[model samples]
Target chain A: MWGGGADMADPALRPIQRDWLSKTLAGLVLGAILALACSGLFARLNTAMPLGVRGQLAMWMVPPVWLGVLGGVYFFSSGVRAWLWLGAASAFVTGVFYLL
Target chain B: MRSEFVRIYKAVHTWTGIVAGMALFIAFYAGALTVFKEPLAAWASPPVAGRMVPLADTPKLIAGVLAADPATARDFTIHMGDAEHVPGRMGWQVRDTDADDHDESSVRHYVGTLDATGQARIEASHPSQLASFIDVLHRVVGLPVDSDPNRWVMGLVAALYALALISGVVVLLPSLVKDFFALRLGKNLKRMWLDAHNVVGIVSLPFHLVMALTAVVFAYHDGIYIVQDKFVHDGKWGTAFQRQQPAAAAPGRDPASMLPPLELIARAQAFAPGFEPTALQYQQVTGPRAVVRVWGKDAAAVSPRARGGFAALDPYTGKVINSDFLPGRQSTPNLFVSSFFALHMAAFGGTAVQWMYFLLGLAGAWLFYSGNLLWVESRRRKRPRDGGEVPAQRRDVRLMAAATVGVCLGCVCGISLTIVGAKWAYALVGDANAWLLPVYYTTFFGCIVWAFLQGAAKAAVHLLWLAVMAALAIPLTSGLAAVAPGLNMWVNTSLSSLGVDITACVGAAALGWMARATARRVRQGGADSVWSEGPQPCLQGGVPGVGVQAK
Candidate 1:
């Protein structure tokens, strides 16, 4: 359904009619969980560092990791797979975080 | 990698850019001004009559003031330099608990000096809120107040902005090598706009990335700390940073017996040779955990914070207590994290870097404006080639164009007009600080209404001229104040204040040029585009249908 080049000089090379809604939800919810879990894990692992400094480093790490996930989520082939895979990854990270 | 992935990223980039572009425009524009926030504050404040107390007499001054007014003993700043904004040698602020945490306007300012007979002279001082108002606009994306809700909004915008940056890079990967420094200025307006947008976006990618990340951190830092406290520190984060308390309750230390200001500066300079101590901030000097923070910057090193790093010292012993935040003396790990704050706030490399950041900030604002322009251009419904009736542009496209023009130029007009209004408000009402927000919001919303009532094509030019005139008025008011002493207005001829006027003159000239160019484009350029004046016989020289590739 992506065929229009008569008048417009440039058009899309392929259609991008993916499951945008579910992909967005997965990115927003699961990405945040993963980022928070990773931050907590880092803070826990770096016990040698001062608590203040380590906590600061951990707090600063959340936005970049979360945004990185949000930016990469659309590369998944399907929205359901995107949700399932990200959910499993988040679960693993969170499980480790809780164990610590 | 694949064409399909590129297409998807392209869509992501376009939508995010469209949604966050206008707010980012306001942020970058005001942020550029905030780079010189100190100078703007100096320019806005009227001259005070009190001279700075001599450095040797500061101990007596502090003692006398503290005995007279015990409230200031909690926290107070001793000014070393004589800037126009420094009301007295010693000053402190009493902030209203009801106001927002970030709100500076609700704070009551008091400054103390020694009178002729050596008695303490304390008065309620009124400093200008102009700079802080502009900073609030920058911090919260043109929100009226720097409240928690506004910061959350800014955080969401920053998140979207980060997403856009990533998707934008992905979309441009294929053409990255070929279009590094390419700026094709030809009949193809779309291509020219696209090239300009790409050059600015890619060249300043690092700056934009730092801003996006730091902005999110600044907005939600309270929330981040809460999460960290709950999960990582188990609600004991506060105790870790607290100072070690004495075993028994100690007697109150005397402010009079503390080390002199010069001695404190010497101690800080000895600790870090390159650090220039501008002020000494005494926190709880009368209490058991008395500490003095020597605040200033070392030009050769990256400052840990915007106001600059400080070396904390024991006020009584003249011993350095903490050098972790000192500019040239930070630990390696601290320096790594401070680099992010330094890069975001332009706290390194001094004046040349500040000017570079100013120009880069303007270019960033242009990036957003051009992004919106490209969007409207791509959606333009061209006239039939056979000379049929002109097709009306899509309502969404028209609405977007109007909103972009209104929001962006309205911000320009609002800021300039409010700056000029400061002088008038001071002269007329005797307190310009109280009237800053009313002046800004009135002009901001007024321009928005004007843009909607008059279509985008007309409103863009009108607001541009309004911006030009308003900017020109800044220097003109100063000139009038200088010549006409009868007007009872003040003019500070300090280098920093004059810098504000001179920069405004340059800004006015630039806005004038843009107004002329936009007027020409509306009258004579593409008749079918959203920027055009009205319906016309045929399309102009531009290729009507060729859009920016993958836009």
Candidate 2:
């Protein structure tokens, strides 16, 4: 996970002061998108099953999946890439569901 | 850790823990007490002979109630009296007309109790809101959920909490196996705190995971259900669930001919062995097909969710209609969902489990408290032992210390005081519910201001004493009332009442002990520490420890 900085370890934890506002906001937005997309993905997979089965599995699965995606976003080295990737995934899913 | 992942995770763990610690402390502490919600409720409202109706006499009482509130024939309950839920009474549920048919809602409730001469008397009943208040405090202590949009504020916190859990485990991975049980009581307070905090955080990881994830679902269940109903189900929830019907009774059977209370309990036992019906609810009493819901607990069932297993029966024919939620008869999906509810509510395994949860809850609260302490300690700059000044950068620690002491202790005291207030509330106010907020907020804010003004070390001893006094009042007021000539003799007769008194006494004793321990720590601890009252590091600035760097 160490990139470019040979001397230092875990550059991510160095407490970057500059552009913190942007990073925080961006992380929040991207995390939310990824969470929603993951939930929709679970829902889509369960579509062939009965409604009760779908509901049950969704209840058991969705929250953790959503939370996992949310936590996963903070791992990225760059906030811009995190936002861009999550935003793109969200759009792709939204379009797929919209068409269906 | 040698890798950057450790450092990054360390930051993540630190930030998430700091952000969620305060709310989680309230949640865990209140949640721990909520395990005994029924006992607490009973303690709040002691039973009187007038309120308790014998099971054999309930039929006559129901007849009388039907005469008084004929609407009750449609839907009512003969609240089976017990030790935990004192004062057996009857309830009439009024439903909202506009809500969706399956989107169940009971708009208003009126309760009936028998008078001395066997007539039914009804009142606008208010179940003491103290247990519920504590439960809500456990859920959304900082932001009031009622005012929050989408009601997802708790969900967001839960997400952060999950992150905290993950990152915390990550940071501890280096020493996870080696230092799991090491409780070093050396001079290094930070090491001791870290060890203690990590042990608790790791040991209770399963419980915390269940709570955090379930809390999110609970907070966002409405939205999730909507997605499932509209998008997933495509508006066929009723069809998908395959609602079952009774085999015995036909339509238009008279509810008046329904099996009596005693028989209902007997039949419920037949359906599920050892199913003890605590409450008999008659639903749709006005409609053509009225049903009786025999709600109670089954000793054999594993999950401990409140309300236990129930079988909806045809009141006229005593035929079991819906026992899907019954202990022995749950579907695979039902069992799965039931397990979650059971774990979330600690509804399974009875009193012993409840006690375990209560202790773990207290431990969880301690973990958060120590997390904050570690944060404050991390920033404490080292200085020479020769009375030399350290940097003034200790103000953040000072403020955080004050806030941590103030808000956390304030919640603890506020709950205890409110329980004490229950002894006097109904007698004092026309609107008793109105008094609860004022009583709690007054103590909570007062403690906060006091902490800031007097500092955390000074306020800790005082607040602990206040907490002890407040908790003692719960048992004392009731115990002493027994000696009074005019006060009711019910508390003297009930074990639940005595249990509440005894538990409160124990809690008060614990608080008293904590106060003494804290006072000693304040008096004798290190000089450069925020907890220390020895001497302010003679830094350049007037500030105690905000920014003065260590030499």
Candidate 3:
């Protein structure tokens, strides 16, 4: 029924349709790890700013950005790429955050 | 014409929407009702509330509460129930479970008003926590009662919810211009549902964004605050807004030395001009650290909390002591933070915005519900209605259909029926508020079981009846109260109270209409669906026992 002339009913695409379990694990784990570390790092970067505005801004910015990162992961060109990109990005950010 | 990224985003939208749609539905539905929390609370409170002791005699009532219980002398408040709606109320803490900790939600409060003889009598009897109950349901989904784990659960769900919003927008972007308002209502049911989902979602994107971001902040504010404290300020942020202690009360200094509540409100005006006093909360009224936080809002000032500007006054001299976050007096950064909060809470805008947010909330609920329906529809088995062998639907789709009907309708019927119980069944229980929890949980799980036993079409009709019955009970209970015996008229004499009845009637009418439409869909609709008369009724006529009739 897809207008693309290739439906998900094709045997080649059935496996992708059934890949929900792996996607869930990747989304939950990679998504959360990146979200927390990135929010913490942003708040840290803003410590030099006057007043407590940086902290307050962190609260508003962190969640949306986290979800953006998650969207980036899932919207990658391939499922394998989605997993690899999310894993590498999450590790790099978290490792750098601790190192800095 | 869609790109690979758009295709991937479509999958992301589908998955995240499936994950978060149900919880989001409950949150949005209850959250809509919570916009008018004060009015709902006023409507549900007993008539005794309307008799609040006059502002002229508030000090006398205060003195009485202090004298009746020495512990109450620690902290008491004069609740400024507007003379028109919720008059005659004062509150005091009976016992400090956590000593000197004033702001914890767990503290037991004793609220009452003065009697005819002008005596401060503690009215221990309360009608129902209808408003607060609904607000609490919006915050936490009634599993573990707002513990940290629950907050984390909701917070993570919010993260997923945010992902859903992002992906949904991405998928809709390429066709955003031409198909923005295109609602093709003809043969394609999926197209129509998708359009409705997309239209509602796109229109309310800002509102949903604020909700998602704010939910994350609210849920993990403690952790975020800690991160700020340790990393940002080297643990010095704890003292950022700390108020300097007042001169210690001399031994034998009577608390009667403190200024009256009116004088405190007047002094608060010196800090925030045109401050409309709503409530005055006094902490440590008799102790050396006694402070009276006068909560009033200057309508001219935009505040984040629904409550107006706050001024912590020196109770003894009626002098303004703290004004850092007070509306019209807050610092720029503080004001920005407060403005963000006010945006989410809709505290800045008046009643019109409140109504707008209410409609937005209901629309949000519809978006989630329809999302779930679209998911189930996507996987429904295809077959002819007249005859031939039909395959079973996907287990996941069947389960989602049951859950979509069960959890969402369960929440609606639960809240409605509990409020009905609050109105009519209070006399039967030891505590009406306590009684509603059971009423909600029972109905919630009961609907889920029923949905599984009977499939989508039949379950939808029955559960809708339950929803209509529960909703109708609200106005019905109030209407019967006026004419019935043993139930003294608890309706407030104000038009606001009557508006609640009207709203309930409107809600019931909507549910009734929904029920009728669902029944119509079961008969003579497309039989190539689970919602239609498919197998267990694929034969020429219908199912043996069940009521599925095929043409």
Candidate 4:
């Protein structure tokens, strides 16, 4: 039944019979990591900076993160590609946040 | 199964967007301007010197006033002026129970200045009518007081806005990536509108979502009360609401003592280590057991809502009774609420955040405007020449166009005119708020009527030009009215006036751009006739050559 249904499934999912599952899982992991990192940075800024400056940072942080993620998802060639790009971007943002 | 869910969400998104788009646009546009309410209020008041008073004198003056009137002492609120945004004046409201056997309120303002002993002295100034007018507009969108209908309507609109936002996210899930950074300008009308909508929606999605949700929260908090009563509290909504209420002080019978004001202040400071006390309230001043309430501001707090780190002190003994810190269970939610407020008011970050929200708000407004245009464009070719046999769809489009242009641009012009009217009213009538607030609504309604008659293209062009011209003239008008010599001196002396003038100039520039665009459209002869699939004469008897009779 699995094999029969597989034929009707998305073409993009065919690669998931082997290594693609790991990548998809990794992408999900990366997304979580980035969300946490950004949230943490926001928290720190809220506590460390002046109320006004923190507010400004929050305004800036919200737009880019939300837009970037949404844009990456929509503009990518395929669902898998979208996920991969999202993962990479998330990881990169997380790394940048850590450094800051 | 996944695709089925996606399709269902898409339908929901479209319907929600179409239903709530116009109302959301109005809310956002007005709300963005409300961030600078204080500055706007200041702009309305004429510049006056010797407004600032020493903090120490506030307590003594308050004590003296309370000593004279026993009832005023029980429930009193202090008004502190921001140096940049507010005039240095201490205003108070006293509730007189003796008059009419009910609470009769009186508003008195005192000019804050230092005396020979370096203490703050109180004197009266003219009442602020302009500020109150702006406040009403910001809170109620110029709704008539007699009609309770407007509140429910506004509340319903806020709910619909939330629904629309949710639907928007669901719809964008599919194409969010392809159009993420894609703001392809100067293209097919539909495509351009779609791109613009997507970019603005995605960029400001969180801000918009928070705004929509919180607006509903504010407007329909009563709904929550009802819900909690019916469901959460098992028919005890009143009790739940009461639980959230401030605790009343227990009655005390000890003899009154002369307490040092400095001792109370010192105790309050120690209670909230990091916060600065903005106001100190002595409850039942002559009574034996008086409660001194100290309201403090947290330096790291983003909004006024979050700055309420309070301490209640025993006036005579200089001992702390109670304090309000962010509760553990509610800290996150409270902070979220505060941050949302901060973002909405542009109070968290300085000018940069304010500018960003302002720009995005304008873009969001445009997005709604374009969305309406797109809908009109889609039906234009199919519309009939005569009013008779008009399809419901075409009628809907016409109404939407009239309303969208009328209300949005009308609000801009109305608000600007209100500010100017406020100043004039202050100078002439001495009570600007009474006449000025009415003028705002009258102008807004008049603009709507004008838009309805003029049609979208002409109304858009004319209003844009008028607004631009009016805004640009504001600074010059203000300067001419000023007794001061130079613009710099005016700005330095009165920050509120300066801010208003600068804002006016910016508003004028924006309107000018809009005016130019509208003119180009007029010159192009109504670029694409909505009624016809092909290019037809602008507004020349509905879709030409389409045989579809009006439904």
CAPRI verdict (incorrect, acceptable, medium, high) for model 4: incorrect
The lDDT for every candidate, in the order shown, is: 0.87, 0.71, 0.72, 0.55
DockQ of each two-chain model: 0.40, 0.29, 0.29, 0.03
**Residue B48 displacement in candidate 2 (angstroms):** 3.0
Candidate 2 residue spans exceeding 4 A from truth: A1-50, A77-100, B49-51, B82-86, B93-109, B113-121, B142-151, B237-253, B390-393, B427-432, B487-493, B534-551
Instruction: For candidate 4, write residues B1-551 as lDDT tens digits.
Output: 13433454455456555676666566556665665565666676655655455555655655555444445555444444455434453444433334321111133444344556655455565545554454445444455331235555765565555555655666677778877979776735667667777777788788776666455455544544443334223453344212232366444433135355555667766655555666565666545456677665554455434234456676667777654332111244345545655655554445566678767777777766666666666566333544444233344555566677778777778777877776667666667657765777787888787765665667777778767866766676677666544422233346655877887897788789878876776566333442222222123235446343332
Give the Å error, residue B181, model 2: 1.1
- By summed lDDT, the worst window of 10 consecutive residues in model 2 chain B runs over B99-108
Task: Write out fnat for all predictions, comma-separated.
Answer: 0.65, 0.37, 0.48, 0.00
Residue B427 deviation, candidate 3, in Å?
3.2
**Model 4 ranges with Cα > 4 A deviation:** A1-100, B1-15, B47-53, B78-89, B94-126, B142-149, B234-276, B281-293, B302-312, B315-322, B325-360, B380-396, B483-492, B530-551
Question: How far in Å is the alpha carbon of A85 misplaced in model 1?
Answer: 2.5
Better of 1 and 4 by DockQ: 1
Model 3 CA deviation exceeding 4 Å by range = A1-54, A75-100, B49-51, B82-88, B94-107, B112-127, B142-144, B246-253, B298-301, B384-392, B533-551
What's model 4's lDDT at B392? 30
| Candidate 2 lDDT, A6-84, residue by residue in tens | 4356565654232334445655665455545555566676576556755766655667866665555555555655556
Q: Give residue B59's error in model 3 in angstroms.
A: 2.0
Tell me how far the alpha carbon of residue B465 in candidate 4 is from the true structure, in angstroms, after superposition: 0.9
